[model samples]
Target: MQKRPNKISRSRRKNSAQTIFTRFMLIVAFFILWIGGIGVRLVHLQINQHEWLAEQAQDQRRNQVKSKQLRGTIYDRTERALAMSVQAKSLFADPAEIEDVEGTAKKVAAVLKLKPSDVFNQLTKAKVENKRFVYLARKLDEDAAEKINDALKNTDLRKFDEPRFAGLHWKEEQKRSYPQKTLAAQVVGFSNAEDVGSAGIEQSQEGLLHGAVIKKWQDRDRLGRVYDETELEEDERELPKDVVLTISNSIQYKTEQALEAGVKASNAKSGMAIVLDPKTGEILAMANYPTFDPNRFNEVAPESLTNRAVQSMYSPGSVFKLITYAAALQENMIKPDGEIDCRKGFIEVGGHRFNDPHATKVMSYGDAFAVSSNYAAIKTALGLGKDRFYNYALEFGFGSPTGIELPAEARGQIRPPGTWFGDSLASMSIGYELNVTALQAASAYA
Candidate 1:
């Protein structure tokens, strides 16, 4: 019995040791497989996926911008520059390179005098969408751009070797500049940042003054520093044509100075003047009161933009008598020295009395004209009849546009004899029953 118990104890001890050894071997095998799997994954990523990840990182930091060629210049008759394009700086950003977007946006806005919330929203949207580029400001002034550069360098957040923030950057662009701020403002007009002409000659000659648009790309580094740059190279043929105006710069200056003084002295609401060559009818100078600078056209009153010399219409008053006298003289209705009676200083026509402020009675046509006698003019027009008068009126270019190559030219008003009242001819003769622009009256006599 004692020998059997000793054999059983030996067998149990042997079985327990075998179970313990098997358990240790299984644990070791599991650890080896886990480590080997990790190594395989590391190798695949390094060899196969490296290119794709690197491309992604590069794309995140890459910056590209569309650039345009400079526009053609505008010169006066003497080849003096009235409007030209100058190089200006524009601010931009890349959200992918920017960290702490909210904080960066606040600083940018404060320095740029922009709305903080606007900057934050734009930056946040770009970051969420993984966009590479965004514009912060366009066509910044020299002082303004310098202020941004100074702020970046002097800020507390700047490091010794790097900028205070990422994504803030600047690029060159063309800005329209006018040397003569208010001179010929209405005639010269102005353009917008899109290189589009909005008013005056700028609007009319858009095809000639606006240049071509070309794409230009510039590469930037992670800290928002440009490493590679490209520029727009254009020959004269590819650029827009420079415009030469008929206006004389010296004449324009003198005309504006005189007009401004006259308007101020007269205390008039507004006024305009145009000097034209009688021989060729070429306009030398056109001026208007209450003018605005093209550089700051946005701040002017809307009424001031009107080119009143061609647009506004008013009755020529006593000026129409010249037309009547010439028409009567042409048809042989009266001679320049014919006799007319204006002793009463007033005459009755269709129960309405018309008075001559300064009248001479029983005078020659010459004397009547010299005195501006209303009676003599009325009688002559009646003798000619409305039919002949209407023909002469149309011949004088009344009731028609002058075709001045200017915007909004007004066509003066004239009624046919068929539409006239019994006294219409009389009123027309005295310059009362018709509308005429200043240009029309001057043209009639010219």
Candidate 2:
């Protein structure tokens, strides 16, 4: 009995030791896993998520503001301002800083002719969303802005003192003005709200007209209040250069009036007219019907904004015969007094019959050209052959843009010799299949 009791005590002691050893191993494993998890989290935060956390922290205490300089003025040859930028005011607010949103909205609405309830809603929404800056009005007139400024300053007055607008502020902005209204609108083009030119000379000379952009950094306090606004000076800042066009405003007006009258009298859909100084290749005037005022360009159709003189392509008709006759004369294939058989007033070539409106028989080359006889021109072009005619067309600036300082100028279509159809020569002789811009035709005549 003593031996059996000793055996049982030894077995209980072994089991107790085994249980303790298992618990110790489990605790050690758990501690190692916990340390590993902490190390991995530290590595992710320090390396992978470092930039993202840093940006979030920086964004809390810094803000960027953009200040725009005035865009350059566009002047005519007489130094008359066609387009200019005038100093104006843009109203903005910091919703977080506003004390009484309703009062401020009502006051601003009264001055800006806006709906008070709408303004109030916008202000309240911005505040709820924690927006720092919100625009109330952009590019207000100087006089109107001054009135608002005066109202804001008169805080001691009975009406002004009760509902004070705390965060309303005005910043200097530029508004583009066209002094002459619709005069030379297409030639001068128009700039958008950001002072970027959209067409005409404005677009072609965008580099010279666009001004330097000023960047400013503002610091904020712990409460998110902005302070210490600083402008960073850039070495590349350059004052915008003005563009002086060769267009004459007076002549442009006269031409525009005449074209308008003519189109109205004839009941035409639309018309275009261009005046140029042959001696200097200067465009004195370019006029198009259905014009729009640059000041109100946003309200007009896109088609009305096009400069038709350089943009539209049409068959030159009789105008192109000058080139053909000149080519024939230059090539010694026909003389000024050379006679061509035009008694029939019509001729057939490449299975196409071309008819002349003039009812003349045999006549001199000069007479044929004077009457614009299609038969004479076709015969002359045929005699000159396709190669010489094509070469002369290229030399006369056909089938290409005139390289004018205008946007969207069309390079009139001219098919190569290989692409020419069997009746191409006959059709092209009197300007049937060919296309040319008005500027190109004028340049050719010059």
Judged by lDDT, which candidate is best? 2
lDDT value, residue 180 of candidate 1? 84
In candidate 1, residue 31 scores what lDDT? 86
**RMSD of candidates 1 onward, in order:** 6.4, 12.7
**What digit string (tens of lDDT, one per residue) describes model 1 on residues 302-404?**
8999888777888877789888889989998788878877787887776678888766558888878777778888888888888998899999999998877
lDDT of 2 by residue, 262-357 (tens): 999999978888888999999889889889999988899999998888899999888989899999989989998989888787788878777777
lDDT of each: 0.81, 0.86
User: Between which residue pairs do clashes occur in model 2?
Assistant: 343-361
Candidate 1 — worst ten consecutive residues by lDDT sum? 154-163
Can you give the TM-score per candidate against the true fold?
0.75, 0.78
